[model samples]
Target: MNIGIVVFPGSNCDRDCAYVASDVIGQSAQFIWHQETSLGEMDAIILPGGFSYGDYLRTGAIAHLSPIMDAVKAFAKQGGLVLGICNGFQILLESGLLPGAMLRNRGLSFRCEEVYVRVENAETPFTNQCHPGQVLKIPIAHAEGNYYTDPVTLSSLQANAQVIFRYCDADGQSTGPSNPNGSLDHIAGIRNAAGNVLGMMPHPERCAERALNNTDGFLVFQSMVASLKTQARLTAR
Candidate 1:
């Protein structure tokens, strides 16, 4: 599989995502600049974490207007896989690829720490390698990781199984203290109604390598690659 990592002006983790896609996952990876209007032949698209446009207007306000987002949205509409991390998740919200909005952390301070997230729906392409109720220790860094949505949308998400990951204790229980950003229902990640696009606050690439002493995050990438391989096989047949 070939992954395309979008690079905005303030994007700092594009290289990390690229390394995971190419070096660790043994898939071709390329950097797609914000100005680029096309996604080319990428199998998957990733919006990496960073303070795009310095987060001046809003976390992803200005960045979402980039010409590339049009392509991203179109790709997702065509059943392409899209994953957004941290600021990338913010961009997805701003671009309307995913639902909901991000608010300031509970205390309005930047948080950088490790948090455990329980897999809520492991049947999605992005989480197929994980089992239901599995816990993953991932690191999150942001001031506006708090997720919010209207009651109706929340209910819809729950009914449709769009909620993928939720902050939880090591024992896989959701609790207040385990909620790092005070996100409603401790939502750590969610997918679009179509399940092809995913937006999450945690940085999986940061903990995907053994050198980092934690390979739990690697499962996210592994699942994506595995899903793509399965799709290729089906297509060939």
Candidate 2:
């Protein structure tokens, strides 16, 4: 599959994502600069984690108006797959492609460590390889990753199974201070109602290899590719 990794001015993890996508995920991945107007032909697009525009205005506020976002929006409207990691998630929220918003961590500090998140729903394209209630060891490095939403939206999310991952303890229990960011209901990740777009605060690309000693993040990427393959097969039939 051909993947496009969006790179903004302050994007630091673009190379890391491309490395994993090419060497580990075995996909043809390329960087799409922020100023670029075209996404070319790509099966999937990823907005890697980083401080876009140096986070001058807000986490993703400045980058949301980037020229490429219009193309990304159009891409998503066509039912193309899109994944946003870390600050990219913020961009998705800002661009109105995903629901909810982010706030500063409840600890009022930057959290840069590994945390556990349980797969609340594995039916989506991003988590088809992960079993329901399975805990994944993923790294999160951000200060404003706290996710929040209203009561009605939260209710809809739960009813539709849009909540993909939630912070939890090592044993997969969603209790205690395991929720590093104070995300509402420990929500760490979510997908659009259509299930084609996903936005998450965790950095899955950072631990998709053996050197990371935790390859749990690979399941998310592998699942997306596998899902696309399945869709192609079904379409062919």
Candidate 3:
């Protein structure tokens, strides 16, 4: 699996995602700068987490119009898999690839911690390796992670099964305290209508190693690789 890790001006997790791709997933990750016009035959793309454009003009606003986004959109329109973590998630929302918007944390502070995430829709490519209700530990680090959308949008999201992950307690259960950002409906992640693109606040790349005391995130990436592999095989047959 050749992965392309997108690196915007302030992307802090690009190397981290690449580290996991090369070391754990055993695939070389090519870093694609934000100004690049093409994805260059990549199997998948990851928009790593960080305060893009230093969070100026609101999170992900300036970065949304980056030159590479057009190519990124083209890729996703073709059913290519895209995973946006943290600031990447914000970019997705800004780009209208995913529904909803992020707001300043209800507490108004940067938060970093390991939290449990319940897999709500494993039927999608991102989390297809896990079963519904399975709990995974993923780290979330962000200052503006509170997710919000209007009633109509939220309803449509629910109707489409786009809500994929929710915050959970240490026992793998949902609670107000466990959901640090107080996102409506405890949502931690969501997918595009087509289910090929996913944007989640949690950093799965950070949780890819057991020695890091978390490996739950790896399955989701592995799941995508597996799903794409199966689809390719089916098409070839």
TM-scores for every candidate against the unseen true structure: 0.99, 0.98, 0.97
Write one digit per residue (lDDT tens) for candidate 1, span 69-127: 99999999999999999999999999999989999999888999999999999999899
| Steric clash pairs (candidate 3) | none
What are the lDDT figures for the candidates, one per model?
0.96, 0.94, 0.92
Q: Judged by lDDT, which candidate is best?
A: 1
The reply for model 2, stretches above 4 Å from the true place, is: none
- Total clashes, candidate 3? 0
Candidate 2 overall Cα lDDT vs. reference? 0.94
Residue-level error in angstroms, candidate 3, position 7: 0.5
The Cα error of candidate 2 at residue 208, in Å, is 0.5
Candidate 3 residue lDDT tens string, 1-237: 789999999999999999988898888789999999999998899999998899998999999999999999999999999999999999999999998999998888788988888998989989989999999888899999899999999999999999999998867789889989888888999999999999999999998888888789999888878887898899899
lDDT of 2 by residue, 116-151 (tens): 999999988899998989999999999998999889
Is 1 or 3 the stronger prediction by lDDT?
1
